[model samples]
Structures are given as structure tokens and as C-alpha cells.
Target: MTNRYRSVFDIIGPIMIGPSSSHTAGAVAIGHVANRLFHAPIKEVVVRYFESFAQTHRGHGTDYAIISGVLGFDPADRRVPLAVDLARRQGLKITFIEDQGLSPIGHPNTAAVTLINAEKEITVWGCSVGGGTIEIRKVDLNGLIFTPQGPLPILFVEANQPIGAALDQLFGENYRRPRVTHQLADHYIYQLDLLDRPFPEQIDQARGMSQDLTLL
Candidate 1:
């Protein structure tokens, strides 16, 4: 794993409701980030747990925590305990699968969540690396890897055409250079870790650059 911890808070953990930070809070963080990356109203969700997460999810509230995060709830949200009921009431279908046979090369607290809607589907693979921290390893069938660090805003842009130059010009000098992943010959995903919250106009500019852009 890359050295993702940047501050004392990363070591100390986040302010969240938890029985175990790794299983509960970290799970929520992963789900929340996945939801953000999906950037669409989810109609269905399928979560596959691996190894440790597969064995201890129910007991550790990992299931509920993940559901809560998928519903766009933060770790400290009061509705976490009732995430299942809430999801049902909101017409969201959810399923859980325990795949203990998966390869154990990565973190033990790992899960792959698939979010589905009418137009598109997105799969996010993430791991809770303790202390309420998480690392998103993959998105869809591509190697889109990243870790959300503090207030740094992450913008995901997916497009069929080449928009890197436009993005470079739009964020020129003001933001950190983006990490780009080529998922297909003509399709790309740009992950930009911004120094500050982008202005509404800037976001609109990005959206205009590519109809597929989704700002987090």
C-alpha cells in the first residue's frame, strides 16, 4: 500500500460512530467515496466482502455502515443504524455477498461495491485500512486507484473524447495536476485532487468540457 497518511488525524482517525474504526467507520468511508465516484442516484447496490470483512461484517456493523455510506450518509450520521430500512423505504435494492475465496494479496478489510442505475453501472473496489481510513483501489474494470485525503476535493471526469488538454487549461496553476487513467481507447477518467473547493463557475467549466464529467 502507498503511504496515504498525510497528517496526525489520518493516524488518529475520524469523528465517527463506531464499535471498530476499521470495520465500521472505515467501511462507511469507503462506501461514501464509492457513492461520490458513482455520482448517480443508485437504484441497486451489490456488495461483495472478502476475507476478514466477509467473516466479521455482520458482527462489526460493517453491513449497515456500508449501506449508510452508499446512501450518502457520513460515518457520524444518526441514520447509520437503520440504513437497511432507510434504503428499502427509498426504493433502493441492496444485496451482500461474502467471497472468502478471493486472493489475499491486498488488505483483509476489502470489499467491492457495484452501484447500478438505469443508464450506467459502476463498480468500486476499496479497503478499510484501519483508523477510519480507506483506499479506493479500482473503479469499474479499470485501475482507477486513489485515497481521499482530508479536504482535498477529488473530481472524476469520464469522457469518450480526449479532454486532458482542456482540463489542464481549466485547472492551470490553481490546482494540483490530475491523475489520468485510460479505461478504453477513447474513454478516460481524470482524478483531480484540488487544493481548494472549486468555484461553481469552475465546476461548470469542467462540466462543459465533457458531458460525462462528474465533480465530487
Candidate 2:
């Protein structure tokens, strides 16, 4: 089950820092993605750790990693605990649980996370592989895996319409300052009107749809 063109890096790389890559790095990635998918300030979060993550998570700072991620901090930062404190000080309610039965399929460090905000709730299931690399296995309690990171259909127009020098030719004038926000991936979450456009030409839309992007 390996693709020839997929680099070793694809299998083995995710930049992060931690007590343990699986517990710390993976947990952080999960929290970060959940926060983004929700696309709003998370007022409350509950993380349920499983298997190895539950057993050795505390020693590896999994709790702090998840809390920091919910607060928008990267997993590579040494100040993850500080971020947790900052969230608490900012009145974010974060809770943790250790549950072993969530992932009967695979992955030893699986976790189910539920996030709450003023108007919505999001649940994500994820697993942390070694070396801080993480895969967001599912979202919205769907059981189907979906990862928010990387490219997908929601990004087609932005990819085709590059915001900088490329767009200068089409807009009828040279613009020194780039119109950046509209082109950023995160911005689209706030602009739902733009979601239906076809994806970039180079992307294999069918393949992207076939496999659940869940599980890094």
C-alpha cells in the first residue's frame, strides 16, 4: 500500500516539537485542525485520548499539546503549556478524557475531540504517528475520515487565480500591493459563497474524493 511517486517525506515528515511525537505533536495537530474546521473561537473543548495516547499522554504533555492547539498554537512550540494557561486565562474551557474504544480500526494513539463555540459544535477523530506527524481521521462525528490540512475542492479558484504577479495581467493594471486575504485558504471558510468552484486543474479531484483525507 505505497505509491511509487510519493516521497519518503510524505510518509515521514511533519514539523513539530514535543515530549513525544505521537502524544504531543499529533495531539497538537488534531487540536489545530479542529479549531480551523470550526472556523470560530472555541469556547469549550473536550479531548478523549485512547490507547497509547491515553496511557502515556500526560508524561508526553498530550494535554498541554491539545490545549495549546485549541488556542491556535503550533505543536512545535516549547511554550505549549503557556498557551494552555493563556487559553484558561482567556476563559476557554478545555477538558480531557481517556477513552480506548473509539478507534477499533487502527492507530494506537487515536483521540476523539469535540469542540464548542458560540454557534456550533465540531467533533474530530485523529491519530498521531511517530515524529510529530498527525492525521485528522474524521470530523463532525462522521466516522468517515477527513483532514482539513492540504489542498482540496474548496481551493480551486484561489489556486487558479494567484493573488500576486499572476493576477496583475488579468486585472487590467499593475498593482504593487497584493490582495492577499481572498487568496488564503483560511479565508474561504468565512466566505461560503465561493465554495462551489471546480478545483485546480492539476489536482486529481476524483482521488481526493475517493479516499477519506482523514489519517495523515
User: Which candidate leads in lDDT?
Assistant: 1
Where does model 1 exceed 4 Å of error?
103-105, 141-154, 159-161, 166-188, 191-208, 212-216
Per-residue alpha-carbon lDDT of candidate 1 for residues 1-26, written as tens digits (9 for 90 to 100): 54556568878758888788989998
Give the winner by TM-score. Answer: 1
- In the range 123-155, model 2's lDDT, one tens digit per residue, is 877777566656554555222233333211122
lDDT of each prediction vs. the true structure? Answer: 0.76, 0.57
Model 2 residue runs over 4 Å out of place are 3-15, 102-105, 141-216
Candidate 1 residue 184 Cα shift, in angstroms, is 7.1
Considering summed lDDT, which 10 consecutive residues are worst modelled in model 2? 187-196
Candidate 1: lDDT over CA atoms?
Answer: 0.76
Once all C-alphas are superposed, what RMSD does model 2 give against the true structure? 11.1
What local lDDT score does residue 184 receive in model 1, on the 0 to 100 scale?
69
